[model samples]
Target: MISAAGLLVQQRALAGRDYRLIGHSGARAAFSLGRWRIALEVLLWAVLALVLAAPLLALVASSLVPAYGVPLNFNTISLSAYAEILFRQSITLTALKNSLILASAAALGLLTVTVPAAYLLTRRKGALANLIAILIEIPYALPGIVLAVAFILTFAAPLPVVGLSLYGTIWIILAAYFSSFLAVSLKPVLSAFLQMDPALEEAARLAGAGFFRRMRDVLLPLVAPAAGASVILVFLIAANELTVSALLWSAGTQTLGVAIFNLDDSGSSDLASALSVLVVILVIALMAALEYLAKHLPEGVLPWRN
Candidate 1:
């Protein structure tokens, strides 16, 4: 009954209507998806605030209070606890010093061992290298408590030649640290080496560059960022180490972690909390510094970075 012209007009009208419906449906879907995304983001932040931020705030509040049972308020807040731990307490100062030394030494010591070892393992890739890599990782894979026990058994006896005992000394703790965190330090350096192009080293070698010169000039520069990252990571972990030191510490060898435990055990929770707050501050500062350096470093050098 319709003319051709009329049929075209009807078809165009229906097509326009369908286009409008499709657009409306698409808009609705987009809006729904955006709302869900926003909701999920909010939920994630809420969970982080509840789980992480709340506890940290509570810890800060606890550290500010003058006494353990006292409520934290403008009037009740005091820095006396911090002063007591920082100045009045010899034990705390000693622990802090010991922790700093141990952290620095462990970081530097591990770097010396891991850099060459990583290079060799990555370059050679033989059965011996594989076995050695496994050995390096074994101590780290073991639980801290188990590692501590093993170290105690191994070092309980005095040295054969020198007859020196390392059972209850800072040296033993350092040794344990070396054993446990070797893998931590090795991983980043090894990753760096693996990602490196061997041709650069070979080119230098062809140009009459000796081993030391090649490492100093070419390899070290390339892997320095990773090495630095390894140092920072190891230092952070070693500074707050607990398990190994708990078993191996002696009178003068108490570390920051042990000191905190001791303070709490002695009913000095305020002091303990104050010390913990300082440690938290230190850790945050270090993390922020590391994050800042992330841009300069290689892609996977820092673990927390992408």
Candidate 2:
């Protein structure tokens, strides 16, 4: 307590000294510090973005070159490398189909499960809501590999419970994604729900609308931003899903990512690089779209709702 009092006294003395000595000059110094901080922040962001993007740029340049070397120019760029994989075979097509299918399914599944889950969760309060929130966030704690192993073990049961065997199928992949992404998807949605007024929902119910009708009309329009954000997040995760899909994929169920790994394993550098570029381009497109959507989206009630 004495130390605290002494610190307080020191702060007051320093403030008094500054005010008496510098007078109005302190305001200029404070503004200078703020500008310095802003400049530093902008510079830091530029450096970080460059650091992350440098390797991807190198990959693109390398993939476009007919011969792989340490040249820092695009003079040797050729479309043949791109053409070789995209036009050369059917497996890339198959992989593309699989990736689209998997990502779409994962996004839809996340929407199906998390929307209702987030809405209903708003009904609870205090400890129950906190517990559910924690539970929803548990997936972020588990590594992808751990989740994959757990999923395989849990669903690999061969006892034929009611004629369902989830041991070896694409459904396992879908389930793994649903388990992993539901938490991230729910956070945005739940935040939206918390900001939304309960009266809108109550009005729907009072007007003789069923639960589905209310969700379809009232809640969904408000939560559309969150839903779109969740879909994009889930799709990106599903498209690049490597660890679980790699472990779980069998002979006939190889995703595009798994197929790329297979090409790398088989020393098919050309094909791997080609697919890598393709995947990168596709990701870029998706991210661009998401960014555009996020910017133009009608601000949802959640952010500044009363």
Candidate 3:
């Protein structure tokens, strides 16, 4: 129907137009895809936060519901359950104190050990340093229950000592708490340090600052926010820790977490729920404090921001 030369030229022109249309379509699709990806990422984070928060909010609301005959219908609500748990109990009060003391103490102990060690570990990378790093890893690599059992084996018995034992003591709690979370407390700050410029520290040291003075005035203040966040995380883990507490707790030294479990075993969800809600509140308060501290912290110190 057409000459070969004419058909070839016509076909090339048609092909050119088709390619241009395809290219434009692809460009438009890419723009749409980029926008969708960003929206999806934002949506995912928002949904995750909401999902994580929903159960806690529900527990708090349910705990505040009345336990007795004034059944709530469509919109009826009351605080009888909260009042009953909060005011009408005494163990919870003890639990409150016990949890606070144990958690805060454990956090303090972790920082005491971890901060210096973390700094030291990052400052040098040699044989002894590697050994220390590996040793810290030993606790984290094994299951927590295994470590709990190991502690009980070592400290609960007097194989090496004729009369010394730390069984069922606060020290045991602190030891487990320290061992369990030391790595987490160290890792973030260590990574931050590795990425951070060391010249700042060197300059300060050269300007006649002693080692302890430099740590106190320079590095500590600089990394304090990460340290604060680590403190809160370790404290929360310590406060809510049950495995070691259950295995190693003395009657006189039972933490609130274990105590709550004990109470609930006697079939008191109301009390357990109250404790759960309180723990949530305690963690929230700790997070709020960490956030407040972060707000005041200088940019170079907690550069990660979260």
Cα error, candidate 2, residue 281 (Å)? 1.8
Descending-lDDT candidate ranking:
1, 2, 3
RMSD of each: 17.0, 11.0, 16.0
TM-scores of the models, in the order given: 0.87, 0.75, 0.73
- Which residues of candidate 1, in runs, are more than 4 Å off? 1-33
Q: Which candidate is the best by lDDT?
A: 1
Position 123, candidate 3: lDDT: 80
Worst 10 residues of 1 by lDDT: 16-25
Evaluated at residue 194, the lDDT of candidate 3 is: 52
Which pairs of residues collide in model 3?
A: none
User: For candidate 2, lDDT tens digit of each residue in 51-128?
Assistant: 977777776777776655636356666767678788886778877787788888888778887888887777754556
In order, the Cα lDDT scores of the candidates are 0.85, 0.73, 0.69
Clashes of 2: 0
Backbone Cα, N, C clashes tallied per candidate: 0, 0, 0
| Model 3 segments more than 4 A misplaced | 1-54, 65-78, 159-162, 295-306
Worst 10 residues of 3 by lDDT: 18-27
Candidate 2: 10-residue stretch with minimal lDDT: 16-25
